[model samples]
Target: MLDANLKSQLKAYLERVTQPIEIVASLDDGAKSQELLGLLRDIQGLSSLITLRDDGTDARKPSFSLNRPGADISLRFAGIPLGHEFTSLVLALLQVGGHPSKESPDTLAQIAALQGNFVFETYFSLSCQNCPDVVQALNLMAVLNPNVKHVAIDGALFQEEVDARQVMAVPSVYLNGEPFGQGRMGVEEILAKVDASASTRQAEKLNAQAPFDVLVIGGGPAGAAAAIYAARKGIRTGVAAERFGGQVLDTLAIENFISVKETEGPKLASALEEHVKQYDVDIMNLQRAEQLIPGRDGALHEVRFAGGASLKAKALIIATGARWREMNVPGEQKYRNHGVAYCPHCDGPLFKGKRVAVIGGGNSGVEAAIDLAGIVSHVTLLEFDSKLRADAVLQRKLGSLPNVTVITEALTTEVTGDGRKVNGLSYKDRQSGDTRHIELEGIFVQIGLLPNSDWLKGAIELSPRGEVMVDARGETDLPGIFAAGDVTTTPYKQIIIAMGEGAKASLAAFDHLIRTSAPE
Candidate 1:
């Protein structure tokens, strides 16, 4: 099933196998089963340490398990894992063959120390870019902890199972047959949920760290740039982020980044992290900044975290970034993941052949409508403005799609749901003040982003819209404190602009540090 070039790459990767591994396939006399078998055979031929077996009896035919002989690991895939999941399959092979994981030592320890028996089943679609992270995380956990078992199921292939479970979203995870979560989650996020004391322990550890010369509060493009620039100055630099990559992780396509012709969000985010790691920057992931306490009376600046930990630094650069804006109407939050979604690229496949609505007329909205038109049966795009704000090229592409209908001067009012899932939504005609509702199986919100500056409301000078007010030097109203990226009043919310602002903020903070008196 793999091309010759792919086989060559797989063979090179299989060279890292340090232990005997088996691909146990549970197949039936079907085309899909044959395809899966062929893929497994190709993988098995890549290395001598790997073997294939088809004499398995799994309830789900065409399923397979990756196991190390005599090991208690339980990792299985209920369908042929291709598309974005192909990476998950490759990682599973390498990890099951005794390759060490790249996760933090503390995270690995936490997984290994878990005591309870946990069985996880994640429903995913082939086209979903966010599903691989969840699938690979659970697979790694299963390999690390014998008590943990994970089975990644393709929702598209197993439609009956998806419908029975009411899985209307990608990366819908279940623990012990109960809904656990439905979204893009990494290993740290998953561990924080499973291990209740993890946050407390992490907070305690963070509280004991020494003060940094420059501390970055986010891990998006801006934060990564600030961390790298500060670290390169031969000073102690640290980055505390809720989730490394921030809103960029949720972004799909990024074509405007300079130098790079085209790239995906996750790939660019990974590159940013890797580049930051090349320096002496200390990255603290999964740490949310709750409150910012500016330095006063020669005291160091302290940033409190939601987990009850606080970090102190001489100067702080806030790049907390922004999150997807919600319609904030009735039943919107109630039916989230059930019928309401913000990411068209991630959740579009789940609503294949179903009617959906795209909110907004900007570039994101137009792009989402264009992308979803091919997957969904029909798309109704609603814009609050009189005219679409997207580029002419995008508007032309959206207009050419027969399955999409664009409606201007439309204001979303309420999301209508059938108690369990969304059935439709109500909107108001801005021009005529007439109320209308459209029947749709899903609603993708692409309005815009809301700055994550709510916590800084009373701490700093904020604009009317809650964005941090900063000068050209990226310096905020408070001395020795700066803000960058979408969280600030920076004009455009672009990745390149964010990085440049971050670098400027870092330089400004460094200059402030050397020019002013040291902390007492």
Candidate 2:
């Protein structure tokens, strides 16, 4: 039981006391649990001793009514409040308790008028140690604004919830029940999103605002690359993206990308994002473009976001990349992290000395099988086609590996798993029409990728495969519009190729701007 002083402090901190706060202990030891509970109670008691005054100062006033009336704030700690994470939690609590202004005076005034509650849910895995920083930043925002409610859900512990949310990566955050952002972020960037969301709401309450310039769609390699170039070229640039890295974040190691010999997808995305920050680019992560229209000038374009805000750009660059097609068979999504994986590099190391299966006969599949054979106990390569579609050299190399077993003309039908994790997969022989199941600990899906240009529709001319068409200089059919990287109908989708396209597009856009500005 909590002491009177501690209970009073907890009550004061809570804006609404509709129900008693439940404390769930994650500690395994019984003795340790009791010790931790006592420690928490002590901390609560200490918190009550401090009082927040309106004069931007804290007073030692002993009162249970310290909370301002009508305050509807809530704090959510996603992980165990330990180590550096504890400091973040404390800061968040202080910001919430004091109701400090986190935005500009105008922005704060606008946010204060917001009636609807804004909820932010951040999903994180325990393996990702970098997630705590994001959790702390969100907590602080919730603390500063009474209208904001923040919750952090553990990705692994709450597998069902994670699946429902489609949480593929760690440190993923959602705003108002929709996917909002991902990866680790600083307090300022987090607060900026909150402000942006609030501002959008405020504008909706009113009507019509000026459109933005240089709306660079997508947050992956091409989009980020375009924003960096546009901003550096003295244009007001804004990047609207569903996620920061597109499919690139899903990759584990990128060896083919030039300059960097070997790097992880997440690390590469982070570096590219950092480069964009060096310029005046406004990166709006977790924001999706729902519609596009031609601007008044006919040469420019306008993009409307899902959040009810619109941006206008003198030039538009479609950089939305592709997503790997998933095997929608049963138990596939359920056991995604447990055994079923798409990227061999991201989760391959975890299955060392275990039986693993690789689906598809493409270059990616053969490469994954060859890589896994070096680490795992056994590697089974399954190909739906009669012959491997990979390069001759790769096909020969994969066949030469003694540990790799090739199953030609095999198509996966089902992924069977114990309630907790995957145990094996069921497949069918395409030629013989025989179905079979193989026992394995891990499965890697390496099917071909689908371009992300479906959203463009006929607004931009695309290839038969739905890839944006670009010229040698990365110029699209439309004047003042250009594209680059994998999203375009470029022959190569490698990292180096994408980076080269990005550079070429930047030069093209710069040249266009210069030519148009010169006196005739």
Candidate 3:
């Protein structure tokens, strides 16, 4: 039996629902034994019925079946539908129900006319918080046309599946059981891929042929700057990106960027985009570059986007930035923005007078905890390793802070909260083997960073930690190709550093052009 208040809330949520909803529960030994059956029955009573199954035989099995009654919607919960998971489930339901009204009928009809079923499976690590937008976009497409099915699998939980599928990074999407694309992509771009995949299978396809003077691979600060500069230099530049702003868009504020004392990430991106449009920059938003090969003369590069569009460029510049690494623990993704945050500068003010937890013992972690202690009511610093890896001065300063509690040998295992937001975290002491749960309103995760150069493969040399290698002038080992911004193996990854690298890379590209094409 479920509580009256919980049932009432669920009923209220289902009242406006206009589509089908389903929940798939895992019955593993370690799974929580809550009253989920009764809740499923209640959901069935409120909305159209859909198939649901127990993962008793195999936890990895995809058990939900869809029977379209003109418009069909479905929601699956692999584990206990509580905390952040419940919110995701509810939102997924609402999205499926409202998707038809959101898109035009002709577009929906065009999608439905496709003969073969297209299944898009997107693999995402819980730590990669930027992946939700991609998932939502695909899920909306799935909702509109029953021919399209979208499945989101947790990368860490399904490591064997990920290995078999050769999924090396987060936010990777597979179409029709084949590796379709990777990284964060938008709705229009995904639809284009779906259409291309369908057309290629039906008829003999020819290679793409498009020409441009310059091709910028990323749409971040450096990429945008390079495109604007090159366009102003009278070169026909084309900028292709999965999404504009790269990882910088995840930041809440740009405090250190020049000229702007404090600007939000979205605002800065908008301004950069406006400035780029002032020139002749051909912007291809929501497009991901799938491959890049040097041209015959070595001065030109052939770049192919995910949707099979090709562009030839005389110069190429890579400005892809880095993404924040995650602390792989349960509930971390579920509570993101609600209480779990990666940037202290972004969500610190919201925790005023509230207890907060800071994960990691590195310099960034210690500094963030110290800075947040002033704003929050209390700060708990949890470090998995034996000792703090921060500098001596920072360790001494943090040790002296009365409001900060440093717990060495502590490893966070789970984040616990109500359906809407985070409330606390559970951890275990490595040495003592004792588990403890701390009630808090916020958790800050600082586990270093991951560069966005995995897709480059061996085409360019990379540092020990996977950052692209660049010389003093931002020239990569590959001739006629340049690397810039945080993706490069630069000492600092600040906005000022990225901007300087952008300018250096542009100048280096110009010099390379001059040397190769002299009027000798």
Candidate 4:
């Protein structure tokens, strides 16, 4: 189950366990059960304080629980926790064994104060990059609060429950036996939903902060760079984002980053956040920007959030970034996370042996088709153009796949589904002007991205496609205001490009601040 190097690492990690822990396994005479037993024995060998038992009685065939003898911590795994979930397993063990967490003190307090009987069941896939955050957060809650108990189940292992619940996506969470959410969610977002007053309290805290010299509106690569640059200038800097990692959190592979040979999106995002924390920048996550109030006659610019809180800054850098472009066809929104998904790498495992469709024939779409062909039974690639727009290498790789079929000049018309989940989709043949429908269990939309500049529409200068228009210095038409990254009119929207743009915008903002005086 674990290799030599992996065993060495696990042994080192288990040394942090301050308390005794028990691993109770519930197994059967199946091959997977035996495999799980082998894994458990390997884990038990790593730590002397850890004991294994086999008198377990879980309904799931191959499952286990990590529990502290006298504590309220109750964490369970329904399948082998490997791949992206491997870190989750390690963190759960450390947390359940009384090791300290890296979460902020405020967040810890929030979890400790939570009241009520909350039972959480999260269905996840091993290949999902977004699942670890959800799983780790919930497991922490279970370890912290006695009222909270979480069971992270592998959706691929338990196909019966997935079909019964019609769970067509990864990180599908259920609270109290009802569907709670179906996407990448962090601790703050989860607390906002479970605790009624969490948002109001957060809004109040944000509203009371002092004004900053530079304020960034996003927390992606651009926002992190801008914040660091501004803070390094010995000025007060602040960053408020809906989520710290932004769209990069949803990305799977990132080989285009110059220095790094190969890396994952979440890993890069974490590094960015950690780098920014070394400075004096005030980092605020899970804050969505709503309205923008430009300063008049050297006044401070104020950015309002959806939570009814606003922050003022001498200069503003808008790096809100972009999100996955959605298919606005009928039934698409209704069946989202039911049968329609955006991140193939995150949700692909849930559709094993199932027929799915990939909309678009670009690099992202074609790449998605190739990746899904291995997990899913068949993949239908549809392109609105006459030919695939992917690179020759990618197109060649996509062509060689036996389980994938490509269609040209096909327009996705509407998503078809029953009341619960998607069943098929309708498309139009551009040449014949005839509509066609294909039955599939899932749909992965990989068209492109849309700029997150909708809120700056009437407040700032924007291009026809909603991208913020900026000059070489990353400054907008309005003085004391700058924009960067994918939200701006940059030629190419790459992560490296975004960071460079963010640094430029921050420096430009600092220059503007030095030249102007704030109104009294």
Candidate 5:
């Protein structure tokens, strides 16, 4: 299944493998398992130092072992390492095969300093490109610290564990059976999380009487930019969110941002956090805003969460972003992070030289098809509308691609996949009244955006589509409140645009604070 060029690349990459690495695949012979076995066999055959062993001597189920040379450190993959998960497999092989870690020496020292028998159980999926980074980071940490143990579980293979933990996101990391974080985390952020998990004071209530000059909600690029701007002005700033990075964490490649030739979502997110931390901003990570309560005395507003934690501020900037709209077709969720993926930039490379289909004919869908066409073997663009809604320029660009086949007025009914991954899509022609099936290895859905403003339903005035309305300065309908990013009435939801809006809102909030005198 490997292309000649890709095969050659893998062969050259594996030449640096100094010691033999053993791969133990104890699969139950499922459809996905067979596919993964073939991939492993191909990889093993390419490298002289690589060995594929099925001793069945290990007592674990659906287990894979990568043993380090001259060390008892053995990293395990308890799932099929396909899709984006392939990166983690390669990282594990190289790490155990005696390759030097890319992490800094100081960072390695800090990791080694963490003395605990903490079991890091990371739930991941193959299609998630971010999960591999987290898994490999933990694997590197384990290699550095003898006390730390890391386990990578394929959430799809272990549905029961995922269900028990109520894991809704990929790359969900649990430190000693408690939620550490989700998504691709930066090294410093993960270290801080590890320290926080070990700290006992996290349960203690923070000072509620402390009022902030400005409070920023949401942690994506917008909120981070907002907090950074507020802090630069020497104001008491606080930014709260479920996790830093917002929807950006779920994205793969981000090349559109000017000056940044190329960057990943997780990397940008971590950098945002790092930049915000450079200032004296009071950041509340893992905080989900529940209710927007009007502030009393000194503070103008207070936001409550499910855990009874509340924060008060003189002004607020709402940056809670939007999420990808799912097609909600059969096998869509079941095969997510398997063969069905939502991120074209993140998971596109995984489907390189493979046939794929894109659902939706809007700008996002067409753009995604265009992006995937350059990486994949062929792209079949299916649109439910009679005519494509994408811009004429985008349509022209998509048309110029010979490998792309555009099908309009196609009503997608189901995503057909074996128990493991998506193999084809079933759709019906709107005018012809004929059903059609297209064989594909991956599917990308780029329907539309659904703003994450449902939580502010009764608290503030929102547009009909649940987008928070804002004026020129990112000021919302309510005074002392502003919004930015995908959650607001911004014509387009772009990172650079959101960051600019966030800075504008923060400056406006500063103006409000200076004029009000109430915070004084």
Candidate 6:
């Protein structure tokens, strides 16, 4: 049931859609179809701009379509829209109504100039927040072009398709019945992968003869900050990264970003890239760094990529970030993006009115519990320690919530799920030597973080935990090289902290350059 506050919010969001959007429901005879139809009726009644129509003729499953008044669109959803995907559905309708696509002019022109026909089948789970972005991007491409066709499938509802295609994860994209890509990707990236002309030739390799004055590795917050600071000093700055936003793109909410009260991961990541473009940093994205070689005779240091392309720089700043730690237990890997997820900020909304569990008793777990308590029906937190490791203030807030339960000294045994999604979790309590299973729809694992420093294996001095060792000024054992962010021994992993460390590393590199020579 929609509350007054939510109804008001939906009303505001729908007011922006001035144009009328026609929805056609293609459903088979079943209880699931009835449920989906009921929800659609409720949504249609929310605003006069939404009009619902019945299409029982060519229906194979409980599917629906969104289009303009006269023409059908490429966007279709095969199953009930619930969890985080509800936002995707609303956005699709709004975009078809009046809201223009957010792609840049260059991106729109590229989509318009596409000559060949392409059909995209994207698989998704309702609880996955990352799946919506890819779906929305593909839908936008379809809206911008007439040759492209797109469909969003609920993986669980269509198990035969999942089994046949081996769809193991959400956002699993297929182009013309062949695997194109998986996971989160930008609109331009998806277009490039499907567009023939864009993928016909190899990218231009790097030139080793020319060297940059300073090269910043990784395109996360830390690397971006370093590149910006160094470029401000009029140095020839360059940055190489596998992706522009790094791990930030995987994050969901940003309540602790300072000054700004709240933000989403992708939004902040986009802004970060936009800000870095204002500088003179030579951005080389989608390139993974493999090896690092020290400079000879005070020449440029060499950084090698996977494809043998290499860059030469006088000084280097390593800001390679970290990824979320996994449970590594049974069902954890099998049910990723199905019922077990690593990011609460992105996937929390999908669990609204559903019971969920948070593993770990640290600040993150407690914070997750507190945040989820407002939306979900209940939150059960499991801690492997005798006492909670979170701050007293956090503990106080956690205790105040009515829908939260805390279990201490418990070891998570396994994540239990059906073949398609998670349903429960098994845990063993240390005190009583008892095993218990909790029936919940989702499990959030926030135990810790693992640095992405395995590639630097023997090249740099690393701690036992694989964190790079650096001094106060972010200088590593290798004199001309510096490390920052979670990859370094910078204590904590946070956006603001990483940004500050990046700035510090850039200044330290600038000081090193002055001691040697100007941007010679």
Q: What is the overall TM-score of model 6 with all chains considered together?
A: 0.75
lDDT of 5 by residue, 1-520 (tens): 5778867877887877887777777766567667667777888888888888765454445677776556666467776776677777777778777777877686777888886677888887665767877888888877677777887988767766665675545777898878887667655557756664422333244334388888898999899999999999998999888778998887667989899999878779879989998999887766677888765454578787644577778898999999888888888988886677777765565566789999889888888999889878999999988899999999999999999999999999999987767889999999999999999988998888899887798889999999998999998877788898889998888999999999999999999888775553
CA error at residue 118 for candidate 6, angstroms: 3.6
Give the per-residue lDDT digits (tens) of candidate 6, residues 1-520.
4557866777788888878888888887798888888878877888898889877453447888788876546778887767667777878877888787766786788887877878888888775657887888888877767788888888767767776665545678888888877788778677656665553232344553368888988999999999999999998999988888888887767899999999877778889989998988788766678998877556678888764578888899999999888878899988886778766655565566789999988988888888879878999999999999999999999999999999999999999987877889999999999999999988999898898888798889999999999999999988779888989999989999999999999999999988875233
The residue ranges of model 6 lying beyond 4 angstroms of the native Cα positions read 1-73, 76-117, 121-132, 152-182, 191-210, 348-355, 371-378, 400-403, 416-428, 432-441, 517-520
TM-score of 3: 0.54
Q: Which clashing pairs does model 4 show?
A: none
Q: After superposition, how far is residue 160 of candidate 4 from its true place, in Å?
A: 0.5
* Per-residue accuracy of model 1 over 93-133 as CA lDDT, tens digit each: 99999999999898899999999989999999887878888
Mark the regions of model 1 whose C-alpha exceeds 4 Å error after superposition: none
Which one wins by lDDT: 1 or 2? 1
lDDT of 2 at 223: 76
RMSD of 4: 0.9
Native-structure RMSD, model 2: 10.4
- The Cα error of candidate 1 at residue 322, in Å, is 0.4
TM-scores across all candidates?
0.98, 0.61, 0.54, 0.99, 0.67, 0.75
Candidates 1 and 6 compared by lDDT, better number = 1
Clash number for every model?
A: 0, 3, 0, 0, 2, 0
- Best-to-worst ranking by lDDT: 4, 1, 6, 5, 3, 2
Local accuracy of candidate 4 as per-residue lDDT tens digits, 1-520: 8999999999999999999999999999999899999999999999988999987999997999999998877789999998999999999999989899999999999999999999999999999999999999999999999999999999999999989999888899999999999888999899999999998998899999998889999999999999999999999999999999898999899999998999999999999999999999899888899899999888989999998898998899999999999989999999999999998998999899999999989999999999999999999999999999999999999989999999999999999998899999999999999999999999999999999988897999999989999999999999999999999999888999999999999999999989987763
- Cα miss at 200, model 6 (Å)? 8.5
